[model samples]
Target: MVGRTNIETGKVTRETALAAFSYRLKTAVAPLVPCAAAMERLHRGARHRILSKGDHILRAGTVADEVFFVHQGLLRYYFNDPNDGGQERTGQFFDEGIVVTDAESFLARVPAKQNFEALETSSIIVLPRTVLNAGYDADHAIDRFGRLMLEEALVGSQRRASRLLTLQPEDRYRLFVETRPEIARRVPQYLIASYLGLTPESLSRIRRRIAGQVG
Candidate 1:
């Protein structure tokens, strides 16, 4: 739906712009939404970025002083285990229409304990944390926008943690497939397994079971 490249600058294409606009309309504005002024200002402030698969958006232990909204492609939030020879522990996957950032680091102005890597070629809108702060202070609409984004992000993080703790592995896999079919459809099996807090072998077994159950 949102696949377009800029003609001259080639940074933020027209289609992605519309994508961001649509995202704001649906997520920020549509529900309890107000005027479009705040969302427009935020969109204008965004710096568009394109990344290929495997690009590192944020390295571990670095300060994530920016927020990014994905317009196309996918990103994975993860940690590389030094003790386990840098084995990746996938924390989360973010796709289009979603904002991705190191929330704890952004809020606390501290180093991130995790890394953000591109799972596929991605188009994203980057907004500096300082800019967002200034906007929040200056405009009530922007403040409301920020609150909504943060609230959703927090709720998602909580839900992910709670489900992982409470659900069985297969149930987690099922929930993932049910809730985030887009991610499940595109991401590699091992990474999906990692995100589901299961080993690849376990996931394979679960898949087999699911197939049998469905069949």
Candidate 2:
């Protein structure tokens, strides 16, 4: 956590910064496999950020120049459909020890096409794309870290895509609980409903039905 506050930036070091970073890195299977020097480089680029609930970490159509590792709380990645009176759809939920990024934009070095917002007050470590790029140039270990991270992200996206196409809403909810029960408990019901592509009432009914079966 970062502690000291910058009067101008409204940012403070929450004191658990380094520990949180370490925790996240441990969960990052690829980053941890890198050499010691690469790990050092990664830590150097990390800066702690404390955000309030509803903060916009990444807005749609903006340049994505950094990647964030969640240290605490939850975040939701959502997009708006302008054509149909600005309907919102959540695409992803990120919790502690997770990395969240707009896939195409972060890698392609283009503007992000999606928005990421904190679902609760959150803490994170930010690493700019420039720093990561330089680290990759300096060490083969760091390059491998980057590649592995990308591969993990790709696999996650594919899983979500497949679920959206093939699974019914109830099956999707069950699979979500099976895969990310912690997130299901921490995130709001509405966001979970959005992620499962269901309305809140429908989710409620599904939950009741499932509970009846279990009982």
Candidate 3:
């Protein structure tokens, strides 16, 4: 899949990429108050970039100077646990149409604790921090958009933390599958297991058990 996507990505021209990104940006801001000036400011600084599968867009100990909007493909946000032999724990997945960034790191001007990696060949729009900040100061609608994005990110983090603290492993997996069936299908089983805080073997057993109940 990665190879196929890379080939397709190589064929995309700058003009084509910018047009697609423009459409996505417009779509995202459509529900908010329309501000042509704000839109133009955003469009002026945005540019397209492509990452092959396994590429890291952001790494630990580095400040997130840019925000990414996923125009195509999948990305994983994860961190290494020193207490657990540096084992990687998946925190979140960003698919098409989602914004990707380490919000705390970006906002506080601190090094990021997590990393963002491409799980599949990905096309993303890169928005520099300067551009976003300028937009916030210049337009009320843009400021509202930024605030809403951060709020959503916070809510997602809180929900994931709550689920991990309160839900059993099997229940977590079941709920994840029920709510994010597309991600369950698209992501590898092992990675999904990690995201659910389960060993692959345990996740396999849970899957078999669920299948048996269905059958």
Candidate 4:
């Protein structure tokens, strides 16, 4: 969502209105921003945890408590489809410099809408939802920042949904790699394949073909 550009023009759109608004709030808010006082206050009670591979950060139907900022490793955001006999697919991969949270749960205070799990051993810095809400209520700047984050998240979801319906499988994989180069390397092939909506065997063949061309 952050680095996306218009496919037709390739022009950088990083300074779009939503991004500017989010940036202003993220840097200006007292308790949620990066000012010295805010940093000190936030660091005082924040918790950091190391999650092993396959650890569930949040499971569907469960309540989510904290928003996680990824410090290291990869995480797969996915869910099981009961109608399809409980098949799982990687909806997205969260990597370093990315914030991974169950947005539906965090925003609505309801059960998680999907499952989040670490694909590899990872470390994350977490701040409780209560802390975020307190900061949001106390600072209009923080509330604006939250809204921007939600807007970006929704845009990303919509794009992914559209791509899944319209793009070819290989094109989807290529676009995913172009967008998330770090994740393309950090996550396993099978997981990446799932995220691209391809079978493992087809993914392997595609990898070999691509490698051959590079060679």
Best model per lDDT: 3
Model 3, residue pairs in steric clash: none
For all candidates in order, the CA lDDT equals: 0.79, 0.78, 0.83, 0.70
Question: Which residue runs does candidate 1 get wrong by more than 4 Å?
Answer: 1-15, 18-27, 30-44, 81-86
Report the Cα lDDT for residue 41, model 1: 61
> Which scores greater on TM-score, model 3 or model 4?
3
Colliding pairs, model 2: 1-15, 1-16, 1-17, 2-13, 2-14, 3-13, 3-14
- C-alpha RMSD for every candidate: 3.3, 4.4, 3.4, 9.3
lDDT of 2 at 73: 69
The 10 consecutive residues of candidate 4 with the worst lDDT sum are 12-21
In terms of lDDT, model 4 sits at: 0.70
Better of 2 and 3 by lDDT: 3
Query: Candidate 3's residue-wise lDDT over 1-215, tens digit each?
Result: 11123435377544555566555555556666647787777878877778899999999999999999877779999999999999999999998777779988998989999999999888888889999898888877677767767877889999999999999999999999999999999999999999999999999999999999999
Reference-based lDDT, residue 99, model 3: 78
lDDT of 4 by residue, 1-215 (tens): 23433322434232332243234346534454444454344455457666778898888998788877665557879988687788887888776556668887887789987898988776666768876776566556556666766776789889999999999887887788788887888878888888888999998888788789889
Reference-based TM-score of each model: 0.85, 0.84, 0.90, 0.77
lDDT of 2: 0.78
Comparing 2 and 4 on lDDT, the stronger one:
2
**lDDT measured at residue 149 in model 1 versus the true structure, 0 to 100:** 86
lDDT of 1 by residue, 154-190 (tens): 8998998899889999899988889889889999999
